[model samples]
Target chain A: MGGKVAVIDYGMGNLHSVASALEHVGAGEVLVTHDAAVIAEADRVVFPGVGAIRDCMAEIRRLRCDELLRSALVEQHKPVLAICVGMQALLQRSDENEGVDCLSLIDGEVRYFGNPLTDSEGTRLKVPHMGWNEVQQMKAHPLWAGIADRTRFYFVHSYYVAATDREMVAASVDYGVSADAALARDNLFAVQFHPEKSATAGLTLLKNFVNWNGQC
Target chain B: MALAKRIIPCLDVENGRVVKGVNFVDIRDAGDPVEIAQRYNDQGADEVTFLDITASHEGRDTTVHTVERIAEQVFIPLTVGGGIRSVDDIRTMLNAGADKVSINTAAIHNPELVRDAAQRFGSQCIVVAIDAKRVGDVDGQPRYEIFTHGGRKPTGIDAVAWARKMADLGAGEILLTSMDRDGTKNGFELGVTRAITDAVEIPVIASGGVGNLDHLVDGVLEGGADAVLAASIFHFGEYTVPEAKAYMAARGIEVRL
Candidate 1:
């Protein structure tokens, strides 16, 4: 059941890696495009980004990805998957670079992990939180199929989301403080980790997304 | 579970081929960079690092092609170091599908490159690699000076201070290699590893001088390193990446096992 998948590209981050992973998972003919017409015609869409929120938003607007994303999720109701900074972009605002506006697909604010991030043991943890950490599944969704309850996913980000709507929290991770790892509403699923680089568990997640029919 | 300490298998490439050498001398071929990298990925390597040891202009271009081949297949995080001199070099590698590019000689020459690269491509994709050698003590304290050209030349910059400076300059990680212990199989230089790890808020990847699995564990627990990188032990098939992870996990260290 391989179908077309579109990976949004707005001159932010490495879009090729995302496209390669999708292709590797046999997700049909994956297209990394900025054209709205191309994204509008795909069976599924993957929104992926990296770097600063302000710059990401700037390009998202410059390329009109913001409007495309809203229409894809609201009007078209296509299955949308967002990764890393792409997930943070779906929030209302962010604390990075002294505050920046976001896409606001979910009612949330992106807050920095803060300087001197420490655990319960009082040991200081590193910023960017770069490494493999377990994501505790909060609820069962189609995306969590065949993956364990606390499978590890690769994460590299300074700020995290604090969603106002608690039900959107699909998964959570504890890194000094608990942060939302994955957020889901109906057709849209967003994660703060890099599943493409997360090894076996990550590949399984992509496989699940490929076959999901946009039904919870 | 907490964030697992990473185990990265470093491949030193020359002329687009993987090689293993002691202190960059008496070098011998290992295997194809992409094939070896795929084996490590199957063995549960947290990340893979490709250090292009090639020096010639044509060889550097070959290294880029090699990186592109590996990035197309290996889905895990891939870091390419050596010969990354300009923002264009970093951009080329990132565009070639590298998750991160580690800067060494270039960062020493112009520290602004770190800031510029980080600002342009985000801090998460930029890693500053420090090749440090121990010098004489100053006021009853041991001092480490940065070295370049494969640890043959010395730069008067303090290793710890440089790590702090690079972190402040927006570097996301530090790949600290001890020149004295590199390729010695004596284990990591825990002293300087802990020193730099504590000095910077960003993650430090303790590299060079790993012989056994315990050495991998020590780099994390004793050295305070967030990750450990080794070449020979894993290259020659003395031990696999999964063996190293299982060894670290059994020692009460958090690893993705």
Candidate 2:
């Protein structure tokens, strides 16, 4: 199959790195573009980010790429992979920006680090949880192909998706509580970590996403 | 569950090829950084740290070129250090596709550099590298001193205290190397490693004295290091990155196996 991966460049994310990584992993025609027509023609789409959730969503809205992306995922049934803040944008709303609405691709809310219900651990655990951490795989999925049981992906984010349904969650990690690290439903998949920065394991995951058989 | 430990291969560069041994001496060319980084990336290295040991004195930063080249080929995170003294330098490296920029001597000389970089680019982009030596002292306490100019000049700063201070100053990660044990291949300084790891809330990468896979595990489990960094073993192809991860996995250390 002729595969063209369109890396959405909405002006608020690391577009080049994600494009380079997909190209390195042998994706045919890794295009970095904000144009809606270019995104519509691609076989797959990768939304990569490393900044504020609201800012990224704003850029997507400004470029009118949000409707294009939403249509691609919901109507076209094309595979969509969201990384880092890009994944957070899949949530309905984020607490980071005071009730800013996300794309609402997944049924969840993005809340900041630290549990308001329980503060027994104190404030030692800083916000924007950075560095390598383990994500426990939940259910079997094509996106996790070749990934080990407890794969450690590099995460750098302050907010997490409190997914509404357990079935929609693909993977989770402990950050004071079991939080959704990955979410998938039908043709859509989102990860809270930077796969381009997660090294080989991350590359393998991306490869799986590109080669997924749509057997979700 | 415990956080998965990272296995990193550090390359000390002079000119373009990888070099080994302490104080940047007894150097042997270990191939191009692009080639080596690709090999490590293919073999599943969690990340790669490149120390441009000669960039400062050469009055030029080769990391930008290195990052540009490797960024074109390798997909994993590439952290560039050495001779990074200002925000402009960090921006140049980041623009070249570096995931993180590590500052050692500059962060020591001016602590605000760390805070400034972290503020502008976020803490995830800032990594503070510390080189320490085991000085013979009372109570056999291993002091964490900062080594500069390729581990030539001793900064005399306590490593543990410095690590805590750097974390407070907005350093997202600490890349701590043992100057005394570097290139020795005997083993990592567990006491020195633990002191810094325990002192700081951020992740600590233990560098220096990794002879085999066992040493990597020891550095993580015994030394309390979040990650282990090695040069000679990986540079000389004594063990591939997969072998190191496999070994760590067998030791029951949570690694990306």
Candidate 3:
């Protein structure tokens, strides 16, 4: 039987597109639902978000998804993927929202792209760093199974994860400093960028997640 | 290490569908906005730009409903433009779930609109779009001229200088389109893209004249564009987003693939 993939829908994500992407990447079955029972039965889970981190976390908490998500990642040890704000929600805290604690899957905080770097001409680079950017792989992981180093991915976030442990970072991308792009610890894999929006390399990553053997 | 850049797919929407043409003529129907957008979203498009090409000509409000519909379906960011002549229009799109609003004709007419939008909605929500063409000057400088009114009117304004002005006005991003190379599939106007990229502090999204993946890569690497936008190849299914990204990655352009 094909493995079941559950995409958490807290009424904040683009559920249709995420489901379509997972299905396209070879997920045997994709379910976009917030029901606890369905999530508990899934072989793998995905958390996708597009809007504010504060609101997403609020919805997850409202639906009591935080506890279930923790169980899935920490106890069940099912492969989990977090996209964009979903990734930020895996952090400890976010500056965007004061005192907002993320799922704490990775030890880090999210901060805005503070103070633009001036070029030789003394012009301040723009903030919110929207558009396609390149990321350098920091270590090998199944999430990046078919991707190479220096791969470009589509990004649109203003805040990024500042993981305390450098070893947890699977990849780093240059915005001003080497910002953590993706993180991994055992079965929990989260990306600051949207793999669902990263194109083929992203699809490869999703395919890898769907096919991963649950090894760190 | 810089942050990962984004790759955006722009759809020139008329009514409720995506449309494109050569030199803005003989506009051919592309496809359903939602379907095409879903395809891009699935293929890993970082964001999508929906320009209401006919809103002004038709004397209607911006395509807020269409933007809302697309936003509801896609999880990635959505930027809505075309006929965004006033701050009210920007607010309407944002309320409908647009992450950003692109101002082209309006900003060209009233330059302060950029600043006002930035002040009201934060700079990150404002995008100034410029359609430029290369014109020969008397001094042989080969200057870039800004075009307004859906690229039919010439303002005699220097493209590079106008980009600087927009930045001064607090435009969060610049969507720079090359009128000459648009839909020609020859490639983007590298000189135009580079000039704007060098002049603007904000991210520059290179639009117009993307025929292949190499053109996309050139827009980012050689043209200095943070993101590349195209419609024809993507609408016609010539290349999927993943395929284009893979091509860019293969060419050392640093795509997400």
Candidate structures ordered by lDDT, highest first: 1, 2, 3
- In candidate 2, stretches whose alpha carbon ends up further than 4 angstroms from where it belongs are A52-68, A71-77, A95-103, A112-137, A140-158, A174-176, A197-201, A211-215, B59-62, B134-142, B212-214
Per-residue lDDT of model 1, residues B159-212, tens digit only: 999999999999999999999888889999898999999999999999989999
Return the candidate ranking by DockQ, descending.
1, 2, 3
RMSD of each: 1.0, 3.8, 6.2
Which stretches of model 3 miss by more than 4 angstroms?
Answer: A97-100, A118-126, A131-134, B1-19, B22-52, B55-172, B178-200, B208-224, B228-257
Each prediction's whole-model lDDT (CA): 0.91, 0.81, 0.80
Please give, as one word, the docking class of candidate 3: incorrect
Which candidate has the highest lDDT of all? 1
Q: Top model by TM-score, which number? A: 1
Runs with alpha carbons beyond 4 Å of true place in candidate 1:
B55-58
Model 3 alpha-carbon miss at residue B138, Å: 16
Give the chain A TM-score for each candidate: 0.98, 0.93, 0.93
CAPRI-style docking class of model 1 based on DockQ = high
Could you tell which candidate, 2 or 3, scores higher by lDDT?
2
Q: Mind giving the per-residue lDDT tens digits that candidate 3 earns over B16-135?
A: 878997877879998888888878887887789888888877754437667767765676668888888898888777767677889998897899999888766656678899999988
